[model samples]
Target: MHFQYCPHCGKKAERKQIGDEGLIPYCTQCEVPLWDMFTTSIIAAVVNECGEIALLRQNYVSQTNHVCVAGIMKLGESAEETVIREVGEELGLKVKSVEFVKSYPYEKKEMLMLGFRAVAEKADFVLSGEVDAAEWVKLEDAPGLLREGSIAWQLVRAVKVIFDDHTLCSQFLRDYVDLPYMKGIRPEDIEDVSEQYVTLFAEERNSDRVKRVHVGGGSAPFFLVSLIEHKTAPDYNVCMQVFRYMVYIWETYEKEAESIQKGMAKREDFLYPPILPIIYYEGAKSWNVPRDFRSRIREGSIFEKYLPNFEYYLVPLRDYSNEMLMEKKDEISLVMMINKLQTAEDIVNFRQLPGKEIEEILKDSPEHLVNIIANVLRAFLLKMNVPVPETERLTDKVREKKMGELFENMEKMDIQAERRNTALEEQRADEANVRANEAEKQAAEERNRAEKEKKRADIAEENSIKLLVELCQDLGASMDAAMQSLRDKKDMTMEEAQKKVEIYWKEPTDIPEKKNSPNG
Candidate 1:
């Protein structure tokens, strides 16, 4: 920038030319150097367990389809931390692990771009406001979505190299274990554990995955992690069924443990290891089921408090977002928030052009997330009584920049139609009142016109008295009769009235008959 005045001292600045630097401005009153400053930013390729690459669509920067998650590095933060924070802030996904890929000079923004590859456990995400859309694209489809030679593409290519090599894949997967959810569990402990540590009874299905988890550096125990989508009413039998599973796990594990103990494995010498059962519930409603075995016993029975209990950890998705899940930062929490709102219009708004209230939920949401929202909106519209366009039409409208105009027009038209439907009587009454007022005005105008003509006749008759008297004498009629004839035929002029009188001039019958014998 070329500054004409110094900000430090209120004095005019002068341009001083240096050897290679083009005319630099300086303040003569106080020494001040003017230089252009640019932002330092980071970009990265974040991948999930399935090897799908995550791409982000920026709010203001890119006019294209999508870009990798990027942001300015905060002061004193390392490039790796910046990448991890950017992914978490924008997409709401915790980066399990991250590795530096490369760096480049971004000429357009005049900033340095540090690239990295981050791995996340949960592929599902919530988006922030700065990101318009996001998507997880496979390596084959990335070419069309990513701008060639850009830092985002360069980082993604590096991630692809790491995925291709088998040795690197195992090493990275082992290193990238998520510690946030699995507290105190290290990558080395998993290596020491073995799979299929539990065998099921004949009636019980033995196909599911079972692992040996060592807790507190103690003897390894066989654990069964079951995901249950339970929806039925909770009963006393539910607890007993869990107890039955525990019995099977213990009975089956003891047989396997003895063989391993006989083989003299260095792991554990115990004859029977404990079988810990974990039940993860995925239900729409909250978990209000009995937690203690005693709760399922007879309420008033004397032995109710003494019964043995079998309880397991229950994790339900519905409980967290019921009240304060509006943070929009938690992926499942945001979904629960929407379910809490349960309004079609809100779903449309949250999916398309989401605002500040639910900021973090949509900051990093992908276009596919929008598609799911669209489906939800469509389902709600189908159930609503108001007029709604076809699903395809609505989808097309929401996908473009003209959605605001289309929504406004739809609301306006709906309001107008509703008014027209409900106010027919009022409109008709108003029209009839206007027409009656107009008819009364026309009648009053006609009466005024008649009076005006009478007045004009009085003036014309007064002005024509001399002519009328002469004409009456010529026509052999009384002046009153001649005047009566003129008044009766008011459409004629004075002369025409006299001519008409000459045609009807007859001595009044009411007057005494005049004798005509003298003239004979």
Candidate 2:
């Protein structure tokens, strides 16, 4: 949601240069950026086993022509779930299987519409109140009922091709291969003789096989195998896995030929299809695993001529930056951008992406894709602890385009956060000062106690000295005796003892606290 004021602190946002995103409306207080928001919905071309499509007459959408079963996606429901729920609610038919066709971006309504090819059992029309009428039309004639080149038409056409194996295979080859032979190949010229090889690792592998008819001067049509392996992490056995799958495909083709009693499996003239191996890695970690099947073999270089060598093409998502991804401006890139966000901070800061950049990313995207992306982003934000009300404010701010006010608001929030931080710091400093003052007062009290103890010791020494001299004089002993007593009792040097005796003998009457002495 584009923010004029920071939703967190209710302050105006500020335009600040944040990383590679350039200038963004940064909430200085909460330090969060506003994210883009959109509504998501689904439309489905409902088909039955009887080669007929269930079309609806909704006056709200189109009065004259019929429309597919469509409805807005509800919160907490996946796109597929929404399709199934809508089909059941609007046309009273339970969906058997749903195959995704493509997304349509309805920018006019600011919603994304995901198109699907839903298969349901043929039944009588049990219409909902919203639908005026519902009827089953043959698959071949279904497109003519809807407006040409419209979203519904395209979806039906795609479904028709998908149901017809020959047409779908030929269309896939034409779009995938760059060879000149593909130009002359028609839908009827292709055969759906694909013998898929499934393994325990099939969960990680998406393999497709199609046989193309020989055009102009060729002898017969040959099978073309394309293997697309999806990897979420680096694996050393990936080469072995590809090699095993390729071997299985070749073995299957050989057995089929041998069973038919036509082309000999071991014959030199026997033709085999080209096998293209591709590895699509979307892991966050670096892909450091060996790229070639030969790399897995010991001493592969020495036996290079005998050993098979082939490398898979790697498409790493981590190689693309946000700018580069936005430049691509496709559904894949949009999804990748969402995947690139890892941490909580990264998730929260996604809203800080520039509005112009978002517009450019979704510029030519289908109408349904906008809503899909919006739904995905909304889910991500909600899971990341973003508030519900803030998520609803997503409008194309790039069209309204207010940076100064946004920036000003964000700056004010930043100022408020800074002020709070400053206040907290000052309070801590004041507490520290109080602690220091208490310590100084304690030190002063200790010094006073020490001084009083020293004074008492001095007064006791004076009284003792005077008593020693008086005792010596009364006992008729010489000054030497007093000095000897002082030296023996006080452990003083001869000189110190003599000096003490002389001072006490001369000041015997001036002695302080004379009665307090032991021998007074």
- Per-residue lDDT of model 2, residues 419-476, tens digit only: 5676797799889989998999999999999999999999998788779877987888
Per-residue C-alpha lDDT of model 1 across residues 71-181, encoded as one tens digit per residue: 998999876678778898999998765655568787567888877666676567799988888888764345457775467765654442322222222222232222233
Q: After aligning candidate 1 to the native by TM-score, how far in Å is the CA of 55 from where it should be?
A: 1.0
442 in model 2: Cα distance from truth in Å?
Answer: 57
- Per-candidate clashes come to 9, 23
Q: In candidate 2, what residue range of length 10 has the lowest lDDT sum? A: 403-412
Task: Give each prediction's root-mean-square deviation over alpha carbons.
Answer: 31.8, 27.2
Residue 25 of model 1 has an lDDT of 80
